[model samples]
Target: MVASTGHEPCELGPIDYLVIELPQGTTTLTEQMTDQIIRSVSDRTLRILELLIVERDGAGDLTVTEFEELTDRGLRGLDASLVEILAGEDVHNLASAIAPGRCAVVIVWEYLTATSFTAAVRASGATLVAQGRIPAQAIAATLRGDDEDA
Candidate 1:
């Protein structure tokens, strides 16, 4: 059996999550990164589906803080709430991965769907064969002319 959304399917781009650790003594997100997200969303390059900050104490206990709570708790300049992004279990899993005495900023975003391009591909009967990502380290090494054979 397959599940559906009770509506027609829509073209969607890739979704990815990044976990950025705030080192000890750092409590808030940097303005630079916030501006980047704002710029991307404004330009229609990507959409932030969910954003969260999870803190872990010295005893490895997780403190779950909702994105909306941050707005109330003084996470300045951020005024959006994505309350229904991920399931509770998913949130827990992300929090569990955080190291003690640190907090993680998790951003789940999707590249804006290329609606016309996808439609054109479908009309041309071109089916997706495979999809994968090359690690950034490999790309960096290739760009730097570093030998990857060893």
Candidate 2:
């Protein structure tokens, strides 16, 4: 038997990507962050669909590594299955933006908490048209009345 959502089941939530840059002199993905990622996936708060690490050499060459390659470099607590969702184009595009002599860890994940709500809205014939994120710096400036200084 197969489970269904009355309508076709979708992954049903916002899929978002994050690029975390490590300035020169930083070495590897931290073990603490790896453990947090493991905890989130185990408890279903988030589903990591793709993980890519891009490194830019001082000469501006880029190297892209997928999940397994990252594991070899000490990114623990990740399952090999997540590599299946890697979007080559996505990784390449993000890699192109990295500054020389820096490294960036890119994770594409689904917000599991919003999944059921998304499904219900879809079933009701509603659709999400737009969404945006406000930078924390902007929020802080507003609260500090620093806008006047700008």
Candidate 3:
């Protein structure tokens, strides 16, 4: 769901999506977290494609809110493309991951650091074979000598 950012050459990095659950009873992002995000976007580490809030009620019903309308979220300058990259099924799965009566923020971002490398690889006619991410928990478990997950 990468939309044009109206930038020339359009050499984009890897796109990534994340879901961060808000602590129960809290909807506002912490100042420290906000600062880090601002720094990352400002320094071109990432480009935001979409940002939305999902809330699951006690009855397990789901509701979504666009980040722009949530002025209290403290992400004023940061703008999302609001392209709705996540399909309905994906949103459903994300909602299922949230505990009842809680909320979470869904972020879709492009990794700017790999842009030039990807462009160079393409220029050399190299094709991407495959890509994947290893969960941090798996690394932690392996380091702790937990063979079950290893």
Query: What local distance difference test score does each model get?
Result: 0.70, 0.73, 0.78
Tens-digit lDDT string for candidate 2 (1-150): 112558864544677778888767764567776777878888888888788788889998778876777644444555753645656676777777778899988888877898888777767888777777777778888889899642
lDDT per residue for candidate 3 within 28-129, as digits (tens), equals: 566786788778888989877777788999999988887767765557767643456788788878778889999888888888899889888878888778
lDDT (C-alpha) at residue 23 in model 3: 91
Clashes of 2: 0
User: Lowest summed lDDT over 10 consecutive residues: which window, candidate 1?
Assistant: 72-81
Residues forming the 10-long window of minimal summed lDDT in candidate 3: 1-10
Q: Which of candidates 2 and 3 reaches a greater lDDT?
A: 3
lDDT pick, better of 1 and 3: 3
Question: Any idea what lDDT model 3 has?
Answer: 0.78
TM-scores for every predicted model:
0.75, 0.78, 0.85
Clashes of each: 0, 0, 0
TM-score of candidate 2 on Cα atoms, chains taken together: 0.78
| Displacement of the residue 84 alpha carbon in candidate 2, Å | 4.5
lDDT of 1 at 58: 97
lDDT of each residue in 1-150, candidate 1, tens digit only? 111357866565666777788878765567777778777877778777788777888998777666677653333333452335688788778777788899888888767755456656666888766667787888888888887721
